[model samples]
Target chain A: MSKKLLLAASAAVLLNTSPALAASDADLAAIKADIQAMRAAYESKIEQLEQKVETLSAQQDQTAAKIATVEPAAGEQVATQRPATMQRNIKDSSFNPAIGVILNGKYNSFSENEGDVAGFAIGEEGERGTEGLSIDETELNFSASVDDKFRGSATIALAEHGGETEVEIEEVFIATTALPAGIEVKAGRFFSELGYLNSHHTHTDDFADRPLTNRAFLDGNYGDDGIQVSAVLPTPIYTEIGGGIFRGDDNPAGGAEGSDIGAWTAYGRVGGDIGDKTSWRVGLSTLQADDVSRDANEDEVNFSGDSDLYIADARAVYAPTGNNAEQEIIFQGEYFYRDEDGTYEDTGAATGAVDYDDGQSGWYAQSVYKFAPQWRAGARFSQLYAGDVPTGLVGSALDDEGHDPWAATAMVDWTNSEFSRLRAQYSREEVADGQEDNQFTLQYIMSLGAHGAHNY
Target chain B: MKKLSLMILTLGVLVASPSFAFAKTNIFACAPEWGALAQEIGGDKVDIYTASNANQDIHHMRAKPSLLAAMRKADLVICSGASLEIGWLPILLNKAGNNQVQEGGIGSVMASDYVPLLDVMQEKADRSMGHVHPEGNPHIHLDPNNILFLSKVIAERLSEIDASNSSAYQSNQVSFENSWTQAIAQWDNEGSHLKGQQVVVYHKSWTYLLNWLGMEAVASLEPKPGIPPNASHLKQVLQDIEGKNVKAILIAPFENEKGAKWLSEKANIPIIKLPFTVGGNAQSTDLKTMFDDTLQRLK
Candidate 1:
């Protein structure tokens, strides 16, 4: 017991000496040195504890022998002793939340600069990433069950944008756990579950970047402060229905009035296993925003009116091997159609206004194959159909110029374990007429601390 | 319009009600072993659904929507639970929206909570340790003694949940204990020759079984707990097992056998594929026969 206390004290001393804010290289080195010292101390202390335990167990065996000779219930005594050998002192963890952190970095090379998609105004975060080596987003997550009735989770992301470090709250919400009749309620800021991939974090992506369809339609991810109510219908197969009302400050919808719902959504999904080797899911969803101002092309274009979007998503997974541990293949795709009755204003280069009443559509299909436990290869193709531009706004950002945009991407990634992954990707993108670019990317993602299980 | 509304209301009522008039308590077993155990204790008084079969690794379940559908109707949730189901069980519980089977609820049965666990980490675990569970190894069902102990706990939980069938559950548990105790004694007497034998294992999953039999694991094919075997690591393991009088290389049904096969050929040792759980093989149809098959294979 004294040794345990001494070890604790020494650990505290070493921890105190380590730098708290390890943002710089010097501070990181100092922290590494501190960890090394602590590890050495713990190793020696563990040796001493092992020696002490050995002597104590020797004495215990002698005492047990003496007791065995006196007691006639030796069999029962042995039965009880067996459990003691297997039991270990466990730490109590009732009040603390599980914490996790994600580290992302990438090296990107492009043959030409990113150009706006012809006839489509793209929002921020929808464009290609910076060229060259850079640190991507660093996410910190915390989650725990508040009680039997509810659980809460929060994720904060820090990224370097335009040479400035910007911190954003990606998601923070509380969800119901005890509602009856297969009902669940979630409230606060979260990624809206409009489509299958919309709610998934970027860290869990199969490729290093979002597909072109997601970028053009949803600004990579559509999320906002909202309340969502969903229910898993009691059925032999899997079926779910859900809806939400959001504050509409996110990309697809912007500029909300106080206490007014800017957007509303409804979605339904059905899925089941075909056999032991295959599982498939299909979903349909829609989102509507009314009397809200939306902007795109880095805030150079603006639109205000009623906008409605419809989505269809499908995914199927097949494990060629009996178990997924050996080999598996996944095919996923999503189609997006948006109809708008709004006025588009060219806020930048071409200053004009157009009374727009048209529709745009986009779709992407991808397939990923896990040929081995730690290796996966995938390819994706995305294409978009531009909307018609009024005669008054022929040269505006919304003008189609008789060309549609498309991109094809291929990637190969190696996962060292569940906690770390490295990937290489190549893509040919044609965002506008006569504007073609070849892109290459090498990326690494490492997760530290407690990461919860991802939903399928 | 009025007639249409009335017809829809009647259909809604029909779908809302359960399909069966005499509904049994719904048991959602996370693995085949627990499902088999629930069968033994629940008898005809419970409706059982096993989430993952013996061919799937419980640690890497995909949290499929079908699992959520099953969990939504569960009256009891049973799992090994020393973090063995950490990857997906929590998601199912949260999404299932069934309060009675949530953690710490009466309908939740974590078998590790009742039995002692092996391979409990002595220090704070890091990912570098390769998928180590700080609470311990959650594969506790390998020990027949631990299964006997857990049976009593399950019986009490079931009786409390379904009071009208309390007597039935109690009698089933009593019979299970009697047979299990007798089987443990017979196996012990017949399998004394396995004492002090050394074997190589693909994973630490066999810890409880080895501990029960007084056998030891000399080396592992995996370099770490969950890391796949590489060439250098296999060479190291080959050298480590030299002159150790190693009996055989053991693997579970779901585990990839490529590594074990390579090592077996190199070391000139035989590979033994143990029925790690119920339905792992043709003969391992239930809990009793599963152990019988495992003991027979090991011998």
Candidate 2:
């Protein structure tokens, strides 16, 4: 404001200094009057500038005092790379951990009274969700860099199960941040990176429920206390290889005998872009569980032995519109094969122990299309084939009754924003011969707090 | 036969080696503008891999494996920051495990940290405000001065990372500063008439640009930031901009143009889709042309 006034005043003075070609006495008086007005404006502007200077000096003094107090800590632990102001903000935010919460709820309807699939004893969580309106797992997450060398994250899930409120610590892990040579190491309890979807949180799933293959093969989810190390290769194409060792206390793996390692996993993944609009990733993984003692089908069945599982996954995404945020189609599939040689017993039916040695496999294929910015529709088909059941185990939950289980599901979801989604899904599965289970589910998953970017 | 097979195996190993043949520093830019800026400052001494192009929305970017691979080898990582790339950059940095470009590393350059920001939330912000960044708007590259400031930062980091080419980076930055300063003066002269002119915007994407040109943003087509424009919101905008002398409805290349088109037709004003960043349009192939094309279109 003062600069413009000064410029006008200077311009007026220059005009007056120029040769007076046609200047009369009245013109001179008018010019003098203009100069007087400009002087008054300049006087007020100077007063304001002086006030501003006074305040600035006062602020400088306060800052000097603050620096004196902070100087002592600076000597003890020197903070490099971060500006002083940013450091102050980080301190003010109480360690600066990213905190987030996911609110998920669902209303489910099922035609069949029992959700159990014959021939395969799915785990507790693998069963269908609450039959009526109920809140699903609510996840509370917190993550932050512990230091320059490590970063930590934890997730706690709260849900209602069998008329009881259940709180479970789903994942808690610390990962190395500064490992050289593209190698990362993580420790603590985390989901096993067995397949593509297993590593991701269920809230990020394209459908409301896990695929039949995932449910039967890995019991909806597989998380256990473990340590994992992964390395991204230096190749131009995206390639990563990882391995993990876990305690054999989770589904597909049970009680470990003493301090021995329960399960171990190894995986390799490769991905790249096909064009400007499409990208794809393919991965192969294997998990081996030893000394397993598992009870399934509400304790009516017991299996104790070693189990080995292998998985192959493939995913491809094409953005019909250049902006994937607007429109896209995703094709994802996973196949799992498990070979187990174990002893099966029916505790409830008092069936005699039987020696079982066989292999079981399941595969699922799904496609989701985002027809509009907010709307998406998806369809999935899955089938599971069971191995031969010994005579003693025929009446137990492991009995297949010579029928393979298969399911078909269709769903449509609307995203209000990046943080919220509402979905409706319908599915039909014949887990046993001539027993069709028709299921309908309405679910909402809303995220709050920190914005999380989806991983591909 | 064994000796011949061994020789061929050695040859295959050499051929499959992953090390780069050249000595140029690897620069992973989160957006196209930073990629363009890195080019201006690093010149031929850097190999830049920009994660997102001008036609894609960086806010909605996925943490793709390809980006992870690129980040894994990055000697330097440049981004607008201030939570603009918060969704994906953190994931990439964590997964990349590259010591040079990790947070607090010498090669990390978050542009917003250096320049004064606009729209920093004064009070507690909430989700009702629509994806507000408490740190402020991250679109700092729109101001040419901000770009110049970031160029110096990028050059300094490049020098620190690849000190053997320090002189080259410094000299390149000097030349870019000279040309850019001249261009800024020219733009100031040409845009003087645009001072205080009002226009509607599709999003707050052009906050820094409008502020630099002394143009006023009368309203936004979207009801809020990150939200698509709805019928009620468009109607409200129509009423708000009525007789406000809104010269144009400004939008970015990646922004949906439907709301802008509807508003333009209803308000009888033109819709100007700005290149927004480098590679947004044919005329905006580089940093200099991006600004030049933006001003040309605005006029």
B27 in model 2: Cα distance from truth in Å? 0.2
Q: Could you tell me the interface RMSD of model 1?
A: 6.8
lDDT digits (tens) for residues B65-126 of candidate 1? 77888988889999988878877888888777788887777688888877777888887777
Report per-candidate DockQ.
0.30, 0.23
The number of residue pairs in model 1 that clash at the backbone is: 0
Which regions of candidate 1 deviate over 4 angstroms? Answer: A1-95, B1-22
Per-residue lDDT value at B16 in model 1: 63
Error of 1 at A411 (Å): 0.9
Q: What lDDT tens digits, residue by residue, belong to model 1 across residues A1-456?
A: 999999998887677665455336787788899999999899889989999999899889989887877573564334322132111112122225777889999999988776688888888778888789999889998888776688888999998878999999999999998787677899999988887889888989888889888898888888889988777778888887777888988878888988878887778898988878888889998878877688898888988887889999999888886577668898999999999898889877566666888999999999999998889999999999988878877877787688889999999999887788999999998888888889999999998877457577
DockQ leader = 1
Candidate 2 on B205-252: residue-level lDDT in tens? 999999999999999987878888888999999998877888999999
Best candidate per lDDT, number?
2
Model 1 - which docking category? acceptable
| C-alpha lDDT score of every prediction, in listed order | 0.84, 0.85
Off by over 4 Å in 2: A1-95, B1-22
